[model samples]
Target chain A: MTNSEIMTIHQALFIVMALAVLGSAIFVVTTSNLFRAALMLILTFFGIAGLFVLLDIGLFAVAQVLIYIGAISILIIFAVMLTRGMQGMVPRNSQAVAAAVTAGIIFAVLLLLFGPFRVTVDVARWPVFSLFAGNASPRDVGGIAWTPPNQPIPAMPETYIADFGRSLVDGNQYLLPFLLIAFLVDVVLAGAIFIARQRRPAEIIEDRRRQAEEAAEEAEAMRQAGMTPDVAPLPEGAVASTAEH
Target chain B: MDLINDLLKIIGDFIAGIINSIFGFSPFLADLVTMGLAAVMLCTFAALSFMGLTYVERKVVARIQDRVGPNQAGPFGLLQPIADGIKMFTKEDTTPATADRWVYNLAPLVIAVFALTTYAVLPFAPGVVGTNLNVGVFYIIAMGSGSIVAIIMAGWGSNNKYALLGAFRTVAQLVGYEVPMLLNVLPVVMITGSLSLVDIINQQTTLNGNPGIPFIVFFPFSALVFLISGIAETGRSPFDLLEAESEIVAGFHVEYSGMKFALFFLGEYVNALAVAFVFSTLFLGGYAGPVLPPYIWLMLKAAVVFFIFMWLRGTLPRVRVDQMHNLNWKFFVPVSIVHLVVVMALMKLFVTSPALAQANGGVLVTPGAQAAILFVASLLILIGSLAVVARRARILRLQEAAVLEQRRAENIAAVSA
Candidate 1:
């Protein structure tokens, strides 16, 4: 394929993928039903993963699917199922205008930031992007064609995993930040668990008393209607003790 | 034997050749055709494996319980799966009146797709992998995790209370078990110094023509933990609480029928097969054997593992939900963390210290010393943990007895009054 043809094909693919992502994202926010919105959000995640694959970052693409679509989306749907009153359209208020203005300002800031860096961001540096341009020979793209003055560049390390691992743990690189982030995540997880633990003893007693009274009332109503109540009645003493507590 | 090892590659090349010949003018089209053919081949393999596995499971479980299983079809019921398939195809496809129709239909396909995709990175034999992914092990776990989403979808889309509860149990069980499963796998990755399953298998090969040392010998606790968590991940046997018939009436796919139900069934068996394949690859010296083809060896090991799964299913009763959660979060997770620490420490020591190597006449220079040290340390750790567990159990039992006594005293006082 010629360079221009390759570029056109890639551009077409990018446009389609970007459209899918943006469309689904908009749908996710606009959808009334929380369940459908969560599903739309999953589609947005998938489109983003596809874009990552297009960028030749297969690791991140897989991670995106694994972490976002697999874990987070499932959790979101589960929460939606657990909570009642989420099936209807979410009520909108004046805050929507404030949110839109904030989002627009952020978008403008991003554009302004990128405009200065556009000249320095050489697209050829990304071999996969260059492959779409039809200008990256296989050897050049994979570092197989390059050699240093003093040392031979080792046969392009088998897969990028090793390089990624080294970069993560190397002393001069991301090791400290990686460890810090890991610690932070652990702390956050522990805190969440502690906060969401079982209810206190007093709260449990209060809950039991309320449920017992409701059950008694339901049984009384059923008797007035000449029907037998199916619910197992709590012992009178037990209900009294719970209420006292 | 060598020919058998190369069989998949040969078939792949043959298909690619045919595609190239037809689309010679367009390389892109040729590549696309080749990929499509490979995908079809993998899907067919998954389907066939599912059929064969169902037959195997029934027969094996029946024999374990001393009953004749499905003997009315072709010789010894070899055609039973086929008959069942026809029945499934002919059955009415129904959706609940309140179901979210699109999501309901999408769930089964999602399950099947995720189940089949894990095979893409599995190394069946030498040079027979679909793709030698750098993050092959991680990719498998990631893809396998996708099924939880599908289960949740099935549960929610059905708009049934039981289905929703099943979906909740699925997220709790699968996600909880995944932690220890990944933790156990980390030691194997550290030992091999790579995340690729192909590299892991290669590292297990014999160095001087002796039989290869499987990872199970050195890390038996991890192996046990992996198998247990893997069974939970697949929702099999004692851990199959998600679909407990007595409690939830078939769980997430309760609303499905016909081929939609068939897809869920197929996905389950495929998942079992995938887990068995991974277990064999990780700890049982994948595709390594004497006087047999690599692929055959791989299949034989996987079959043995599958038989163990069946045996467990037939023998053990399903655990209660509280028991399952406690086993995973309280028992397996802590054990796995301690095991990871021991492995990392021993590995670092083995790599840095030269005294051990010199003592063993350079034999220790290889991973042998590291493995030996880890094996001994793991044994000690296992014993210690077992003691702790016993002590904890004792304390819980005493507490239970005390509570019972108090209740009895109160009952007596009330009757006397």
Candidate 2:
């Protein structure tokens, strides 16, 4: 099929992304397991990324996929897994209710805001350049290319498309917002660090003590066993120690 | 109004005209040409710059340390980058047995793409952008954010704790710094009233004759904020906590070897250049100089910032992560916000004033009562919110003190018993 035809065909399947988001959201709320919830939330982020692509903000789409899906999602999943006593995390009813209410509000707001905005751009009207043909294809030729009599045309920008590097970082319209965001992020970082520190000081102290003790034990063991103290195999010996425990 | 409508009509017609020109004969052919050109440009720039940047960074760093860098390879180590490239090519490509092969391979490609892709909307010279796409700055911000994800993928895909730790530090640092970096630019946007980089540069040139009041020079506080935040954004010293060699063992790319490692290195330098270039342009009267061509001036500006980055690498000690966040939150963010307000006020008082506006080659910013009123109201709102929070905190503190006193008495009685 020609590029236009493919985009047209894929247009309908775009709803699949929406469905995935819905499914993931449900999973996030309903799943009792914390890890499962985090995983589902990651899927939900992916779905949102897909929606960003559909919205014509390809940069935002990539970012959503990369940041929310790739980095933030992983960090969250790590945090969830790292949380002590995370097993048997029952899905809370209040969380479910909050999620439901939030979703309803978002849907209602979207419907109310965008329902009347008539979008005139049609699937057929979108500029879809066929690549296989050595020349620009006419409408008739495009039709032939999509359901070719024999030879297929090359792909268009839309088909194997990636909009790279369209954003400028120095525009006046963005300068203040950029600075503000930097400042805001700084605040968040400080707050996160402070909270993390405050909550985990005991854990931090314990962790350090354990590590120091382990190191000392390894050194003493190495000396006692007549192994070179300089080449202390603490990392290797830790595995054996854990096995013994 | 008629002129604007006519201009808009003409622009629409021009686009329609171009579409018509390429509409017939088989659109596939046109696609091939466009895509082919894009690919060629992308590869050529990325490949050439990657090599050049590697050599430049090493030599520059070496010089900063009062040592000869790569002089053995052809004329002041001009061919060193080439030698390094060849070395990478000849090295035995190895992947860890425990690594996720697909992700491990994909990590470098994603990093390189994210780095190179940032150049798309950057204007090297007037009317010489890759594509003057709308919302260009926003796109860069978004793409830059994507790079963090790629870093995480690299870290995770490597299956090494050091790499994971590095990636975690990086993600936290980048995400954390991005806010102030963005905040510092808001005043510029407010003043210029356009998102286009070209428009901003053009605006700068228009202020050529003005003394000590170049758009960027005028907003000294914002400029400093942008530069500092830009340095942090690019993960340069003293903010290079993520990839501290002694700390996280080269951070996320610890497991990557051979060409993959090379790609990460290349991505980093290019990313630095990109940030420096953008930062220079945004806050330093980009490409604005006398006794040089405009493009030359642009290059000079970028080079100056690049030098500063290198100098920073040599001179400044890397800040601890806690200090980095503290600097960002307690100082940078609030100060930047206040700076923005001060600038906005200055703009209102000077640029908006009919008398002084014309003096600095600026269009008179007509003082609107609505804008002034809104500004005042927002300021008041912010103050009110702070007051409420402070009161609540005070009450909580008092309650805590009372509880502590009661506990002290109970403890004394227990001791006596």
Candidate 3:
């Protein structure tokens, strides 16, 4: 195939993938069945992962599959199953109009900001983009041969993963953000555990409080009786409260 | 044997050469063809492995229980899996009356596809990887995780209460185990300073006169943690609460039948195989062995690990749901965290101290030194943690005894009255 032909193929594939993503995303929100909606969301995630692969960001693609499709989607499905009345007709609300208006405004703003740019201009500026167009040598665009500005570029490592690791940990790059993310993740984990733990029910708390009050009253009555307190019989409530304590 | 070590690479190159010759003028077509071929090959390998594993597991488990297994089929049950496949293909498929039709139909396919896709990053031999992904290990974990969604789908779409309960357990158990599993993996990545499985294997090779040392020797505790968590991740026996037969009736797949059920079975075995492959790749020195083909060595290691899994299934009883959670949260998670800290600290010490580095020939500490340090540290931590747990158990027992005694005394007083 010629350069233009290859570009056409790629463009076609990209369009199909984009359609799949958008279609699934729309289905996710529109689907009445909660379970089906979760499944649609998973399809959306898979489409996004495919896009990541096309972008040559393989790590993010896999992470997307692992986290979004694997963990989060499962949790969503689990929640859907656990909740009763999921299959019931959803109540119609006026908030849908408001949500649609807000979404439309956001979409319009984004389009005005970025949609008008020409692909030709991007290709001209980054010329590396033309490699995807199949008009340029991939070595210059995809290979680890690009030089950094202001410094003699060193030989590239065997894989970019090492560079990615360094960029995260190196003091001059993303080190602070990386540390912040680690801390934030720990906080989130602790918060999740705190939130998910089984809490004492209000009824149980009320019952315990009533039992304690009854026990205190019984103890006071026994003292008031004052007829050899050591030998005096304790009430059932007092015995239960004492056992609990 | 040496030729066998390069066999996959040789075959790959030969095929590439042919494709290049045919589509010499079009790199795009050439690349496309190559990728398609690789995908087909990977899928075939996964499918074949799944079939072989089923037979192997049945025969092995049967032997463990001192019974003849599948001998009526061709050649010691070699043909049994084929028969089972035929039966599954011809069986009447059913969808539950109340099932969400689309999700119910798609769940098994999703699982099988995801399970096969995980092989894309696994390196079978030197220069014989599907893709030399930079984030290879992470990608594997990620792909493995995708199956959890499928499990949930299977459970929910079945519209069965038992299936839903199984799905809940799947999420709770599998997701819970991932933390410690990833934690255990971190130390290996720390030592190698790379996430690529190939790089990790290369670091352990006996190339350039350096000793080839498996990480298992240096970080046995971490390896144990990884293995245990891995078994749980695969939802295999003893940790197979997701499909506990007596309690939940095959768990999420109870409502499935025919080829859909077969797909789930295939996915499960493939996942088990994937876990074994990863365990061998990360900690068993991958394809590195003396005087044997690299791929063969890798297969041997994986087989041994799979056998161990089967052995464990036969030997250990399934733990209760509460006990499984306690094992993950109270024991594995804390120990994994502590192990990560110790590894990081030792790594820092090795990097900063020139004397220590020099003593180990300018790499991280020699494998022997590393083994000694990690072993001693893990031993101390294990003993200390065990002591604490023992003390807590004793205290709880004593408290129960006291409560019983008080209740008995109260009962005697009431009787006297």
Candidate 4:
């Protein structure tokens, strides 16, 4: 009968979903195995979808599942497999400085653009505050009211997709951006096709001969060690464990 | 007599009331309890259907091959699934020594659970669906794609090259086929103006004393694409098993046996069954019939679709791997896009014209009008595609013939020398 009980349940669901999202995201980065990392990334997407459902935005929730989980995660796994043996380049990167700088830039941009920046400590808030204020004084931050708004949420239209789609193609609305994105996608696709176009027979033969020469050089290197192994290099424990399963 | 038609809803409501009264729970909690009960019921229904489908698939394939199947298991081979179940339960589940243990254990469960979960949004009787989510069809697509990850996990966990290879090929096939399959759903959504299964179904329902026609009649090209892509998605018939036993030895689940193997098998049949159910809902006018109950109508239509899958499996030789991708990407995808564009364009044109919109008395152009325009467009597209394919095939054959002729002449000249 009490509204408090319903609110508590809603809060509980949010907590559970948030934890799942955070835990899986952390696991995605921390896991050494590429496949497991990819799987965890899917879990993160699923949790984010649950959060979307909690927000009562069923379209976003379904779109999250349809695009992020169904498509993007699979693409990630595909890319991971293409990496040397799906063996995630061992966790410790040699280019730590470059990686850190890139990650830091992405983090800063995201902080300036999105997130619960409200949750940030005051010391970590000024750069975001200034950037959001268009380089005005930090104290003059236009969008930074750290407190959540007390206003009631606006009601979403029932046919949100219909209205949104109409606006997307409307000339005064998102038409230019929409068409630009489409053009960009087309250009990117054409570029990829051009770069990966099939070679002539002579070029293919030359490429294969080069590959053979490289392989012969590798074989020579192995033989020069004077204790050449009979078999190819495989992941540790692979061959020995094959019989059990 | 009244209660008979609405019996299932009555039983479900009764259970919800009992949960509410006994637990003194809030209305939302009581509703949750009812949903939990419905989920369990749906699982039971799916498991039973899964068992029956195995027998049906075997018998259907056997009949096509001119052989009797599973007669040794029980009278008329009706009890064959039970015997097979017993065998599966009794077999040993061996884990690979160096396998990723948690992932190996999780993949089968993940796949099986995902398959079972898709049944939740499918409308059974009028009010007998589990949840009726607004995004029911997309939810199903999302769930179906989840199996791709599980397949990858199974392959990776097995630590076998063949299993890995199988996983790669299956993922490629499923993902490629999914594009056209998911594309086919768009025109239905566009036509119905809703993504929910109920809305889609009601769109095909008789309106204003006018007869209703299934979307398949309107967009047979899309239906053909959906059917082919859906069958490929299920890994059945001519598109069965990228991990052919002769090639990769049972694929992603090659390392699985006993109950683990059973779970994979369950996922397979359940996936096929789910696709059949969705096909009926989308194209066969799900649960819409006069005489029998709506649920019965749905089940019958789904069974017919399921039979068609088995018939294809039994009759058609498995497609060459290259041929399968070529059919999906090069043909089905492009055709589905054309079909979708035609339907959307026709609907927009018809709906906006004041003359066509008013002719239906109450709404935009009637389903009949829409069907006529779309069907003709579909036929034209189908004919044009076939002509292109025929010409391409002819050119390929001529090239082969010319090459063969030159080879034969060279052989004769060498013999004379």
Give the winner by DockQ.
Answer: 3
TM-score of every prediction relative to native: 0.82, 0.60, 0.81, 0.86
In angstroms, how far off is B33's CA in candidate 1? 1.6
Tell me, by lDDT, which candidate is best. 1
Candidate 4 C-alpha error for residue A95, in Å? 6.4
Clashing pairs in 3: none
lDDT of each: 0.82, 0.67, 0.81, 0.81
Candidate 1 on B334-394: residue-level lDDT in tens? Answer: 9889989987877666652367456633334455666778888877887888899999999
Q: What lDDT tens digits, residue by residue, belong to model 3 across residues A1-245?
A: 67568558866888988999999987766656566777788889999988887666777788888788877888777666556443433223235456568778978645533454323335566664554545554222323223436653354456665678779999999999999999999999899977666555564466667766776677678878974335444455664554443
Better of 1 and 2 by lDDT: 1
Task: For model 1, name the residue pairs that clash.
Answer: none
Off by over 4 Å in 4: A86-131, A134-139, A142-155, A200-245, B352-366, B405-417
Model 4 chain B: worst 10 consecutive residues (lDDT sum): B358-367
lDDT of 4 by residue, A1-245 (tens): 46667667878999999999989876766656666778898999999999988887877888898788777988887787776564323223245466567777988766655554443334355555555544434444223455556764566767777777898899999999999999999999899877766566576556556655676677778899885757564433453233222
Model 4 pairs in collision: none
For candidate 2, what is the DockQ? 0.11
Rank the candidate models, highest TM-score first. Answer: 4, 1, 3, 2
Q: List candidate 1 stretches off by more than 4 Å.
A: A1-16, A85-103, A115-160, A199-245, B206-211, B352-364, B398-417
Best-fitting candidate, measured by TM-score? 4
The number of clashing residue pairs in model 1 is: 0
Candidate scoring better on DockQ of 1 and 4: 4
